[model samples]
Target chain A: MDAGLIFYGSAIFLMVMGVFIAITGRHLIKILLGIDVFDTGLNLLIVSFGYINGGTAPIFSKYPNIFKNVVDPVPQALVLTAIVIGVAEMAMGLAIVMQIKEKFGTCNIAKLKELKW
Target chain B: MIRRLIALLVSLYLGYILYSFVYVHFPFGERPLRGVAAHYVENGIKEEGATNIVTSIVTLYRGFDTLGEVTVLFLAATGLGLILAGMKREEEEKPEPTLIMETVTKHLFPLVLLFGSYIFIHGHLTPGGGFPAGVVIATGYFMMFIAQRSFTPSEYLLSATESFAGTLYVIVGLLGLALAFSFLDNVMPLGIPNRVFSAGIIPVIYIIIGFKVGSEMTGILLHLKEA
Candidate 1:
C-alpha cells in the first residue's frame, strides 16, 4: 500500500512535469525529455502493479512451491511492449523536429508556424 | 475571441463527462476471473500438456490474437519507417560524451547482450520474456551507438533480421493452418519442461519476435540518430 502511494504520486508528478515541459519549454529536446519522464512514470506504475510482497523469480522447481513468490509476468511483458512503442513515438517526434529545423532553421517552440490544420 | 471561448466551453463539458464515466473502480458483480483462471489452470496443463498457462494461452489457445498483435507492430514499424526514413538527427552545439562513457560502454556492451539473449531464451521458465529481452539487446547496441562516434549499426543486417523474423512468424502461423487445427498451432516437439527445447515452438516463435523487435528498435534508433 505504501509502495502504491509512492508509485501513483511519482507517476502524477512526472506526468505533470511532462505537461509543463511540453507546454512551456523553449527547446524541442526539452519537450522530448519531458515526454520521457512521463513515460518512465507510467512504466513505474505498471511495474508496481506486478509487484508482489516478497516475490522472487518465477522459475519453478519440480516440487511443491509457494505461489506467492512469483509476481505476474504479464504486466512486465506489457511494459516492455509499451517501452518499444514509446521509442517509436519519440523517434518520430525527433524526426519531425529534424525536418522542422531544416525548414524553419530552428527548434524553438515559439517559432512553430505549422500548427494549423 | 468568441470562438476560443466556445471551444473552451465544449472542452470543459467533454472533460467533465469523461471524468464522470471513467476510473471509478466499482465492483462489476461479474464472475471471478481468478476462479476462471484457476479452473483453466487445473484442466489446461492436462489438455495442452504445458505447465505455463500464460504460454499456453498466448501461443496455443489465443495464438491468433498474438499474431494480430505482431502484425500490428509490423504495420506500425513500416509506417514509422516511411515517415522517418530520410529524417536526420540535428545535433546542435554539444560536446561528445566523456571518455569514461566511451571506455565503459565499449567494454560492458557484450555482457549486456549476453544477458539479454539469456533472458529471451529462458523466458518460458523465468520472469523475463521476449519483449524485455529484445529491448535489452537493442539497448546494448544503442549504448554502443551513444558511446562511440562512428559506431553506426548496419541497416542491411537490421532489415534482414526484421524481415526474416516476421516471415518466420507468418510461416509458423501458416504451418498451423496447414497441418494443425488452427493458426500458430503448437506442433513442434515439446521437450522436457524447463529444458532448452521445452515449450515446443513457443520459445522459437518468441525468439523470432525478439529478433524482429530488437532489429526494428535498433533500426529506429539508428535512423533517429543519423537523421
Candidate 2:
C-alpha cells in the first residue's frame, strides 16, 4: 500500500536478480551486466531513501523558500558520483574482459579458474 | 540448473538481509534529514550561490571528493589504454554509410555537442551537470565514428583537451587554496544566482570537469572500439 515499501521492494528484487546473475552467469559480459544491474538497484535505493511524502527537488530556482518539504540532496549528489564511478568501473571491467578473451580465448568463468588463488 | 538454483537461493537470502537492514535503519519517506543535509539545504544557496543544492554539495561542500572521482575515471581510462596497448590493429574494409545517414549524423553532431556544452555551463543553475554532458559529447563523437567509418578523431587533440582541462581544474582548486580559506573554496565572487556565470568556481570547475570527462570518455570508447 505504501509507495516507499513498493519502491524498496522492487529495488531489493532487482538487487537479488543482479546477484543471481553475477553468481550463476558464465560469461564475463553477463557478469558485468549483473554488476550494472546491482549498481542501478543501489542507486534506486538511495534515491528512494531521500524521498519524502510530497517533497520537491532540493533546488531553489522555482521556490526558494520551499525548504520544508524538499527531498534530501545529499543522496542525489552521492548517487551521481557513484553512477560515474560505476561507469568507469564497468568500462575497466569490460577492457579487462577483452584482455582475458584475447589471452584465454574464452570468457567463461569456469575457464578463468586457472588464475585463481 | 542446480548451480543457478543455489545462486538464486543465496541471492534471496542476501536480499532478505538487505531489506531488513534498510527497513530497520532507514525509515523511508518518514523521517527528516538531519545534520549535513539540513545545513546544506539551509545555507547552500546563500553560501554557494547555486540554486541546485546537489550541485553545491558536489562542487562546493565536498569538492575534494569530486576531484578524487575524476582521478578514478582518469585511472580507469589509463588502465584501459594499458590493457589494450599490445593488441594488434587489423585494417579491414568497411561498408560506406548511406548519404542520408551521413548527412543526418553531420547535422546532429553539432547539436549534440552544443547541448552537452550547455548542460555543463549551466550546471550550477540546472539539474544536468558535467558528467551527463561529458557522456553526451562522447555520444556525439561515437555517432560520428559510426557514420564516417574512415574518419578517425585526432588523438592528439583529445589528449590535449583532456590534460588541459584536468590541469585547469587543479589550478582553480589551488587558486582557492591560495586566495580563499581551504582547497576548492569559493574564492571568486558569487554572482547572481540562477545566471549562467554565477556560483563562483562551481561552474568553472564543472566546465573543466566536463571537458576532461568528455575527452576521456571519447578516448575510452575509441580505445574499446580498437580493442
Candidate 3:
C-alpha cells in the first residue's frame, strides 16, 4: 500500500513482459528489443532503490551543501556504465545477425542452426 | 512451453528469495548503500577539487574503467564499419530518392554541433556529461543525412576525429603517469573547485571520451544506413 511498492510492482511487470516477449517473439530484432526492455527494467529497479527522503543532488559546495538526504550516485553511475556496456554487447549481437543474414539469407534463429553439432 | 515454465519458476523463486531484502520494514533494507563507496567519496573533494561527486568518481576513482569502455566503443564501431562496408547490396539498383527537408537540416546542423561541443566542454559541471554529449555530437552528424540525401560522409574525416579523440585520451592518461604517479592519476595541483578548467584531468579525460564516443557513434550510424 505504498508508493515504493507500486514502483516496484511496475518494474517487475516490465521485466515479466520483456521476458515474455523474448520467449514468444520469433523475429530476431524483436528478441533484441525484448532484451533491451528487460535491461531498462533492471535499470529502473537500481535507480529506485537509491531513492532517499527528499534527497538533494550530490553536489558538494562549501558548508555541507546537504547535511542529509542524498539518494545514491552509485546506482546512477552503475546504470550509466551498464547502459554503455549493453550498447557494445547489442552491437556485437547485431553484427553477428547481419553476418548470418548474409550467409543464410534469413534472420530467424530457428532457421540459423545450419551448423549441426 | 518448457522454456516459459522454467523462466516463470526461476523468476518466482528469485522474487521470493529477494522479497525480504527489498521489502524490509525499514525505509531501506539492512544498510543504505554506502557500504563500499565511502572511503573514496569521504575525501574526494580534498583530492579531486570537483564539487560533483559523480564526476569525481567517474573521472578519478575509476578512470581506467572509463578508458576501457571508450576502447570497447571504438572497437565496436570498427567491427561494425568493416561488416557494413563488406555487405554487398543484393537488391536491384534503383534511382536515388530525393533529399527530404534538406535546407532546414543544413541550417540546423551547425547549431546541433555547437550544442554538442558545449555539453562536452561543461560535462564536469553540468547534467550532460561525456557520453550523452558525445551522442549529441553524433546526432549532429546524423542531421547531415537529412540535409543532403545523396551525400555520404568522407570516411577520412570521421576516422580522423575518432583517432584524434582516441589519441587525446591516451595522451592525457600518459600525462597523468608522467607528472603524477600512475596512469590516469589526477595530479597537476587540484585547482579551486567549480572552475571551468578545474579537476586537473577530469575535464580533459571527459572531453576525449566525448569526442571518441561522438565520432564512433556517428560512424556506426552512417555505416548502418541503407546503401
Candidate 4:
C-alpha cells in the first residue's frame, strides 16, 4: 500500500531484466546495455532508500527550517560518483567491443571465442 | 531456450534476495537518519559554508574517494584511447546534415555551453554539480560533431585543458594538506552560505572536476566516432 513500494518494485524489475539481458543476449552491445541497466537499477535503489516520507531535498536554501526532515544525503552523494563512473566504465567496454569487432569481425558473443588473433 | 529460462530463474531469485534484504534492513522511506547523515545535515552548512549538503559530503567529507573516482575515469579514458589506437581510416565522403538538425544544433550549442558553465560555477549552491555540468558541455561538442561535416575536436586544446584541470585538483588538495588538518581540507575562509562566493575550496575543487570531466568526456566521444 505504500508508494515507496512501487519504486522498490521497479528497481527489482530493472535489476532482474538487466541480468536476464546480460546472460541471454548474444550481441556484445546488448550485454553492455544490460550492464548499464543494472547500474541504473542499483542507483535507483540507493536514492529510494534515502527518501523520507515528506522530506524535501537536503539543500539548505530550499528548506531552511527542514533540519529534522531532510532525506539522507550520503546515498545521493554516492550515487553521483557511481553514475559518472558508470559512464567511464561503459565507454571502456564499448572501446573493447570496437577492438573485438576490428579483429574478430563480429559482435556476437558466441562467435568471439577464439583466443589467438 | 533452456539457457534463457535458467538465466531468468536465477536472476529472479537473486533479485528477490536483494529486494528482501534491503526491505528487512531499512524498509522503504520509513527509516530515520542516523550517524553521518545526521551530522552532515546539522552542521554541514555552517562548517562547509555551502547550502548543498551533498556537495559538502562529496568534496569535503569524502574528498579522497572523489579523487580516486576521478582517477578511475581518467584511466578509463586513457585505456579507451589505447585500445582504439593506430586504426587508420580511409577518408570517406562527408554527408551534409539535415537543415533542421543544422539549424537546431547551431542555436542550441551556445546555450548548452552557457548552461553547463552555470551549473559547474555555482555547484556549491545548486542542485546540479560538476559531473552533470561536464557531461552537458561534452553534449554540446557532440552536437557540433554531428552537425558539422569535417569537424573534429582539437587534440591540443582538449589535452591542455584536461591536464591543467587535473593538475589544479591535486594542487588544491595539497594546499589543503599544507594549511589545514589534512588532504582536501576546507582551509580557506567559509564565506556566507547561500551565496555564490561562499564554500571555500569546495567550488574550486568542483570547477577543476568540471573542466577535467568535460575535456575527458569530449575526448571520449570524439575518439569513439567512426572514421
lDDT score, residue B219, model 3? 82
Q: Score the docking of each candidate (DockQ).
A: 0.18, 0.80, 0.43, 0.79
Clashing pairs in 4: none
Name the 10 consecutive residues with the lowest summed lDDT in model 2 chain A.
A60-69
TM-score of 2: 0.96
Best-to-worst order by DockQ is 2, 4, 3, 1
* Clashing pairs in model 2, backbone N/Cα/C closer than 3 A: none
In candidate 1 the C-alpha lDDT for residue A14 amounts to 63
Q: Model 1 TM-score? A: 0.74
Clashes of 2: 0
lDDT (Cα, 0-100) at B181 in candidate 3:
73
Listed per model, the TM-scores of chain A against the true chain A are 0.80, 0.91, 0.84, 0.92
lDDT of each residue in B24-98, candidate 1, tens digit only: 331111213344444444454444544555555555666676666666666666766776666555568667889
**Residue lDDT tens for model 2, B7-94:** 8899999999999999988877886878899899988888999999999999889999999999999999999999889886568887
Model 4, A1-117: lDDT tens per residue?
777669888988898999999999999999999999999999999999999877888888853564578899999999999998899999999998888888788999898877786
Each model's interface RMSD (Å)?
6.5, 1.1, 3.4, 1.3
User: What are the models' TM-scores?
Assistant: 0.74, 0.96, 0.86, 0.96
Tell me the docking grade of candidate 2.
medium
Poorest 10 consecutive residues of model 4 chain B by lDDT? Answer: B87-96
